[model samples]
Target chain A: MIEIKELIKNYGEVRAVDRISCQIAQGECVGLLGLNGAGKTTLLRILACLLTPTSGTVTVDGHDVVRQPEQVRRLIGYLPEEPPLYLEMRVADFLAFVAGIRGVPRMDTGGRVQQALQRCQLEHMAGERIETLSYGYRKRVGIAQAIVHNPPLVILDEPIAGLDPAQIVEMRELIRALRGEHTLVLSSHILAEISQTCDRLLVLQRGRLVGSGTEEEIAGSSGREFRLEVLLRGQRALVEQALGQVEDIDERQLEQRGPDELLLRVVSSQDVRAQLAAQLVGAGLQLLELRRQRDQLEEVFLKLTGSKEGAS
Target chain B: MREVGLLARREFVAFFRSAQGYVIAALYLAMVGLDFNLRVLGGGAKFSSEVVSGFFFELSGFTMFFSVFISMGLIARERETGTMPLLSTSPLSDAHIVMGKYLGALLFLLLITAATIYMPMLIMVHGKVSAGHLLAGYLGVLLLGGATLAVGTFGSAVTRSQIVAVFVSLGIGTPLVLFWLLGRYADRPLNDVFSYLAIHNLHFSPFRSGKVHLRDIVYYFSVIGFFLFAATRMLESRRWR
Candidate 1:
């Protein structure tokens, strides 16, 4: 379990991490979402005991970070955005070194190193020097080193950055496997990755917490809204004219599907699909498909951040 | 202490596995060997004790100079390559990390120091020299190497660039070597102070002359302690900033 109260960090004149309070229960997977300079890295560094908080207090497994840092560090495993690796060390040797420095028993060091290698799916490359590995492999080695000591809390900062599609899938599986073994806190600017991997998220904007919740909860809590997907058997001119008459629709995108049928994407202030269907029918146009896009979390995210994008 | 040992072993292994250690070792040995043959062996000498003392004296300067090169990259290189965060976030204390890197550099320095034993042994075979003098002279080199390496470790801790660390270490070490000259130019209280504080002339001269003083041992140990303490403070302050 981790509890952080009023965690604040200031770098010279600029406040990097403002006073923020959060808690992570044991076995929870939490995602910290932020853009550049949103204090995610700073927060992770504080949790990992790499940096001390300016004023607030953080505790992990009942040990205070400031008062009992060794104890806190013993309970936490941290993987920074850039993995700290010695290019000259082999994978197995590096993991064993990390395990030893982290106070693993001498006799059990090999077993722990093996376990971490297996967990990160690097069993084949255990003897290879870190300098020879690819970026994805190095990242796996980084994660293996972090978790080799079997700490209760694991923190990964941008674990999936710069990974290919297949590597990303494998990494997602690897993170999921760590669910019961440790409480995981990961920070990423990729919203889709967080929405898929984490059970909950804490969103930061300019060093302040703008939102925090599950994806559905964040989407629902923002406000009432609906996204409309309309297929009309009419020309683009008639479709645009019909969408203009619909009240409470904020934006619309009309694409001519064929000579007659058109596809219309409507961002509405409320659910007006029934009224739109009736109006399209009354205007002598066949309403082919009129349905609300279910679970528009991306829309909610963009709305929270004040952005708009259409189907391309 | 066990953690420190483990870290030290890792660091030492890194030194050998990469080209940096071998390169430094080869270059230092070449320089020391060339200097020994040209200045001590090729040149005329009066006594065997003077010849051995000359060998130890010459090696001390090289060891001191090379110690900085060995240790300047110990921590700062890790910081530059973004690897210090790994150690910082580990369960080990800052003291463990600093001491481990220090010992790693010192052990490598000692290894290179031991390699020079052949040059002294060659002298012992042909020349008449006492065992105690040889032991005392080697100890002097080790102590001096420890002091210089500690200064380099402190330099590594202060900055993120190994080049900058080399400059900082040399800046601190060169003045101590030149203090003997300053002692010559001054008078009264200041003159005595500078003379006593000179790293080589005051403290190391007795060892080079086949005499071991407890005060010199204490002075070398103090130099190591003072710089290591400063390094630890630099690490702690960096966390706050």
Candidate 2:
């Protein structure tokens, strides 16, 4: 379990993290989504015990980060954006070294190192120097080091940044594999990345928690209507004219796929898919596809960040 | 204690793996070898004691000079390369990290300084050498090296550039060396104080002459202790930044 209360971090005069509070339960995977300079890195660093918060408190598994730093460090593992590693050391040697520093017992270190290597799929490159490996392999080594001691809580900052497409898929799979074993907190500016891997999202804007919930909750809190896309067997003009009759649609688009196939997309404040299907059939058109299109992750990110840009 | 051993092992292995460590060793050996030939052998000194004393005197110079390079990157390189965060975030305390790093650099210094023993032994073949004299001279060099390396550790901890670390260590060391001269010109009480505080004069002279004074050993340890304490404080204060 992790809890942060009124966490504040300041860099000179700039408030990097401004009095933010959050709680994460055991075995939960939470994603921190934010824009550039949004205090995500600062918050993560503070949680990792790499940087001290200017005020407030953070505790991991009942250990206070400030008062019991050694205990907190033993319970948590951190992977910074650049993946702190000694390039000269071989992958296996580096992981073993980290495991030692992470306070893993002497008798169990070898098995722990092996487990981390196998989990990250780094067994093949275990003997290779980190500097000699490709970027993807190096990242795997980074993740391996973080988990080599099997800390209960893992905090990853921008783990997917600068990774190739294939490597991204590999990393996502690795994160998913950790679901049962560790409570993970990962931060990213990329929305799609968070939505794909994280169980919940904490959206921050200008050093403030603007939203925190599941995808549906965030979308609902945005005060924006869901989009409904419908396909009907009728003239596009008649369906377009009928959609225009609906009073609450913010916008509507009608497209003709064939002589009888009409595609209707409507942005409204409410769920009108059922009413639209009935209206299409009552108007002598065969109803086909009638479903509300969930807002894209990108659109949700924009709404969360764009709304704060003007006021902040 | 195990953490200390692990960190020290890591640092010591790094020195051997990089060409820079061998280069520093080679440079110190070349200087000591040239000095033994030119200053000790070239001088028309018949007594083995004179030759041994000359060798110890010259070796101290190399020890002091090379100690700067040996400890120059102890903490500064980590700060520059951003590896300090890795150590800082570990479960170890600042004191453990500082002590481990200091031990690593000190061990490397001992290895390089010990390698020069052959030159003094070669003198032993031609002229009779006292085991007591040899041990005393080597101890002096180690003490001087330890003090200078501690100062360098302080320099590294206080800055992020190895170049600046070297300059700062030298800047602090040179003044202590000159304090011997200041002692000569000062009045009674001030003269006594300055002479006692002088790094090379009062503290290092007895060892070069085959005399192991308890005061000299205590002085070197005190200097090392003071600087290491400063380095530890500097490391701890960085958490606030």
Candidate 3:
């Protein structure tokens, strides 16, 4: 549904979005994983036709963002990091206004606004003035306005940025509900939020696409180290020698946990537990408590970006 | 046009929804009433035409100020409140958005201009006045208000702060009105150029006297068009910036 090629956006001396390229499929929910200053917002803005790429081209459904912005804009709905809202307007009225400008047929605008309100779960607050609503509801209104026109591709920049835990959960469900019907592309520095909400992940680090795929695929991509704790019925020195024989084992620390048992912690470039088990059996050792230690999203993100800052 | 209308209607209604809009309108009406009671009536019995002319002449100044007040927030406030993305990402062109905002402010100005009709209508009850004259004077008021509002809209587009927008508007317009004074002291061709460019004196005088010259009409539209176009250009530049 979206194609971006070598998109570079520069502001005089500062290159906000460097040579980044990625394709998002129709009906696929793709999350752009990056910390602040990782060019997530700049990239989304370029796709939404709000910013022109300095050197590359971005197209939504076949229309070029630069050459045919109005056409591309018609197919995509965008929510910026901060929800663009008029506080004085009522929830329903504001959605209607957005729908009107988005070129929803005049006769269909009401129905569209109603559908948006229902989908965003804002029906209870439809008549409430936006200024009176809380920040979370305002965010929901922002989502409502974007989808009010029922665009095929929805680009949300940091959709769950400033929400509380409960609000984040609701937002996740709301974004997930929009998955199959509309091609969803959302960006977030939080690994768990992006991983749980999106089907595919594109990890951006310092304005470059470092990895792209599902969580497990990215975990197993390359250069990822797996930590394993194996309890063995052997001497510490013997367990260390056996683990040393296993290939891809980067480091090993063996400790005597019991009379005939040793707790061997092995850090390998890959999942070398099987190799270690085979080698340990050949060395006359019983393997116990053998497992790979890695959190699903955090491990994959740390492996791809190699940054501890976005662990949140 | 439909999009412009939709935007304009929203803007016009906003004036009723907010206390600031009503406060400004009340203050303007109070001042107009006071000026009518003091300067026009207290001066003594005068020609009905003079009273009418005097009203339009002074009302012209207030019209300029009113336009500035109404238009200061046109584009600037949207930027300030972070709502510009709603308009910027839409399928509409910059010209349409600018025109929509201008028309919305103009609608409010027109309503405020309409409210002052009672002051002119009182002339009909007390003395003889031509309907053509009232129409001509009102047309001039609309044109002057429109021209000033367009300039203010341009100012609002160039800045994100409404106060800065106000000063920028007055900075552009105050000189145009004052150019008429500069024309009186200048020599030959320069004087002619300055007088021709003066938004008020040479252009608006003919309309105040119930004479609708096509030249003055074109001048008002040209001012309105040029500024609105400039505002649209500013938006286009900022959108990609």
Q: What is the DockQ of each candidate?
A: 0.71, 0.57, 0.65
TM-scores of all predicted structures? 0.89, 0.91, 0.89
- Per-residue lDDT value at A166 in model 2: 97
CA displacement after TM-score superposition, residue B139 of candidate 3 (Å):
0.7
Poorest 10 consecutive residues of model 1 chain A by lDDT?
A303-312
Q: Quick one: best DockQ, which candidate? A: 1
Which residue runs of candidate 3 sit more than 4 Å off their true CA positions? A226-303, A306-312
Q: Tens digits of per-residue lDDT for model 1 on A194-281?
A: 8889999988766666678887677766774778888888656666667667899888888888887888888877768888887777
TM-score of chain A of 2: 0.85
Report the C-alpha lDDT of model 2 over A1-312, residue by residue, as the tens digit. 999999988888988888899999999999999998888988888888877889999999999888898888888788888888888898888888888877788889899999999999988988988889988887788788788988899999999999999999999999999887999999998887887899899998878888898877887788757788888887766686676556677888888888778788888777676777667776777888887654466787788778877677
TM-score between candidate 3 and the true structure: 0.89
Across all candidates, what is each one's fraction of true contacts kept?
Answer: 0.85, 0.44, 0.69
Q: What TM-score does chain A of each model score against the native chain A?
A: 0.79, 0.85, 0.78
Q: After superposition, how far is residue A245 of candidate 2 from its true place, in Å?
A: 15
Docking class for model 3 is: medium
lDDT (10s digit) by residue, model 2, range B1-241 = 8877788888888888788899998999998898889888885756888888888888888898889998999999888876776778788888888888889988998898889899878878777888898999999999999999999999999999999999999999998788999899999999999998989988888887889999999999999999999999999787766
Worst 10 residues of 3 chain A by lDDT: A303-312
Runs of candidate 1 exceeding 4 Å displacement: A224-299, A305-312
